[model samples]
Target: MLRTGASRLALRSIAGPAARPAAPSFTPPLQWTSRLSSMASRRPQLPPMRQLTPIQGAVLRRAMVGKIDRKAEDRYQHEKLEPHPELVTTTSSVRSAFSEVATPEAPKDVDMMARVKYDFTTIKDTFDLSAVPRQAYLIGLAGVLPYLATSISTVYCAWEINHSVAGYGYFLSAQTAEQLLHFLEPLQVGYGAVILSFLGAIHWGLEFAGYGGNHGYKRYAIGVVAPAVAWPTILMPVEYALITQFMAFTVLYYVDTRAATRGWTPSWYGIYRFVLTFIVGASIVLSLVGRGEVADHIKGIPGAVDRMKNLKDDAQQALSHQEEGIGAQKAADAAKED
Candidate 1:
């Protein structure tokens, strides 16, 4: 205020001719208040404003200036103005899986396929089973049981026969066990043929019903092909028979899927055929593997099995023949001497 008044008086003296009472120095609408400041406690009392000369008033105004604390001002701002609203922090706890086994983490750089142990994608891809009738679905699954049973039984019988012939142990006499093992092979092969024929006959039934539009001999040919392929396998060696049936099942399964795709069979037929064929093929492999030893032994000899019992019997018969010749020679010598 004093600086303003002094500046005004100096301007009035300089422009005495044109100056009117200096219009009150312009005041701003918003007055600044120092909320963080304080006045000095001890101060000199001033004479009345009217009695004071201009110099005295100036001097008194200068003496009255309040001191501001820089530290206090900064502290005030830090406490009040800077932290008007506080920040909030939130945290979440996630639950883990309950299994004891820890999951293996996949490589970040590798594709999903690279992490897989088995390449089963081709077999895994099959049509949905919902389209097949419940009865047919159940029965179709049941059809592979004979293949499964024969395969498993053949392996057990083979092991028993082999062990028995070796004098390791016997479930039955060696002959019985051998017969039993041999018995399983023909059943497996003949059963495979019958199944193949039955599956082909389904196409025949479908054609007769004209479930899909007749395509001349195309469908009939499919029916004939399965039985043709199946029957020849019965005459094959056990190993060859099993391998042939496996291939036949696979090929017919492909055909069945193609028929389904062409709308000749229900959409579910492909999946049904896939399941049955998978089982049958596995069964054939199992049977072939079980008979592997028989295959090895039978080479260069037709239906010949070497066992301890057979060897012993041959040795005993030769010994008796030698003893008889020795007795006959002694008698001839005694006669010649007489």
Candidate 2:
């Protein structure tokens, strides 16, 4: 079990056991105990972990990262933040002598666009309500008041018809309230159509004034679409009209947003339209619902009754004319027989 002859001689020399070992045949008595102990301790031991500083740790991690390892302490940092990344540009001209084209200088915006790596703010910081102007906000809100009033009045009228509330009925009779509801439906639809036309006209005005750069057919086509969509809704029935207007409002708002993004309109126009469109859509939905509930309580108008009666009258007249022709033919036959 001894590694070398020196170890065996040293152990023997420390004990001075050679004097007593001569009694044994060939094996020694103290050597057997040491051989058993050495066999028991033959397994290898593990080393302890080393503690490293941040710089050393970063370097170690960097070595493990890419194929061509980066060595600079200032560079290749773990999760490094570089607000202004280094730009390496050559000042000397290297273009061919026969070439006529010259290189253009890069704009500052080009550099600004290339933000630090893994920047979340670039993606997430999109919407800010404070960017919307106060005048546009207030005016847009005010524009929705008519729609709000009509929607509320419609709901209230429906509720009034179902339950006779005497105190409130003193100012407005149930019949009068019903009449007002009838009036409000047309008013609401007409108002919505007008609003849509007005919204569309803004684009035309902007195009005429050259508010944004000349957008050509793009802006002109947008100006025409709003009025085209809105005008037809006025001719539709109450339910259909409101629904069409709702869709128109939503589509127009989306168009406005695109226009803003394209720099054809003010930056705040999208949010302004969004707030107005939301209120207008809600009002339209409320109006439709209120009208629906009220319709259940009231009987539907007998619009087809007159048409049916007119059809019967026309059939009788046709039968009478046929009878007169048959009588005349019979008379002619009798005269021929005589």
Candidate 3:
């Protein structure tokens, strides 16, 4: 009994715990089971694909094969056309076409003689002298008279000195010749400086008048410097002063010409200035020559008077010789007649 009991205990220990039977699950309804069975039996059917006709299939295939990006198409077109870039007519072509029409033909014959012989009156007319005001002419003539007077006085002084005359019975006298020249030299120098200053001041006036704009500074500088330069020339010798003045006048005329060319002055201003400059330059040269001639005569150098005496004596001798020759010719003719 004890052994059977021990064997039963060992069997129980080896078996550990006895399995309990699972509680009976509740059965679904007959309709539910039939629905689940039908669902299980029926395989899910996919949506039918859209049917394509032969033409449609061909279009689809072509669309897929021939799919072109717009940007790529444009790039391809540009590349394809780039090699033939000269297809379009350029502006050069158009210009060349019109160049022939615009070009003038050369003359078959040229009349150079006729061109040379062209009337000078036409050029004179172009200057429009009539356009110059009466006041301007009067003022200009009045201004020139002083220069003329000085030149005449210079010539007279030279003449009187050469002839050893004491006086001209008018303005010039041998006693006053040196004094007169000294006075005239300073007078000319002062007048030239004044005129140069006046010329420079004109640019200042123009500047103030609003015509100069940003260029007024340059004009102002020139105006100030020109007068300053002219004033120093007066301290030089009389001949040098005159030469300096002459050079200043030339520079002023050049400036005036450039201004006139650029339309800074009146249209007739250039011609007017030219005329005045010519007169002034001539007077200066005359004064210088007269001074030289007078100096030579004062030094007792052979001069105009001596040359004149020689010429006169030669003329008288020639006339006497001619009369003698004529008398001899008459005598010869008489002898031949006999």
Best by lDDT: 2
RMSD values, in order shown: 23.0, 23.5, 29.8
Which stretches of candidate 1 lie above 4 Å from their native place?
A: 1-128, 162-174, 294-338
Which residue ranges in model 3 land beyond 4 Å of their true spot? 1-119, 165-173, 212-214, 297-338
Q: How many backbone clashes does candidate 3 have?
A: 0
- For model 2, how does the per-residue alpha-carbon lDDT over 1-338 read when each residue is reduced to its tens digit? 32344433333333222233344566557878687777658622211113444544444445434444456643657666654323322421445578544344433444443456326564334445577877777787888899889999998887777665752464576777787787788789889988999999899888988887888789988879989998887666688888989998888889999999988998878877877888898999999888898786565422234446778999999999999999999999999999
Better of 2 and 3 by lDDT: 2
By TM-score, how accurate is candidate 1?
A: 0.50
Query: What tens digits encode model 3's per-residue C-alpha lDDT throughout 18-67?
Result: 35579799999999998888765752322112344454444434443544
Model 2 TM-score on a 0 to 1 scale = 0.51
Backbone clash count, each prediction separately? 0, 0, 0
Model 1 lDDT per residue over 262-325, tens place = 9998778888888788888888888877777555433321121233456778999999999999
Alpha-carbon TM-score of each model against the true structure: 0.50, 0.51, 0.49
Candidate closer to the true structure by TM-score (higher is better), 1 or 3: 1
At residue 233, what lDDT does model 1 achieve?
A: 77
Instruction: For each candidate in the order shown, give its overall lDDT on alpha carbons.
Output: 0.70, 0.73, 0.67
lDDT score for candidate 1 against the true structure: 0.70
lDDT, candidate 3, at 302 = 32
lDDT of 3: 0.67
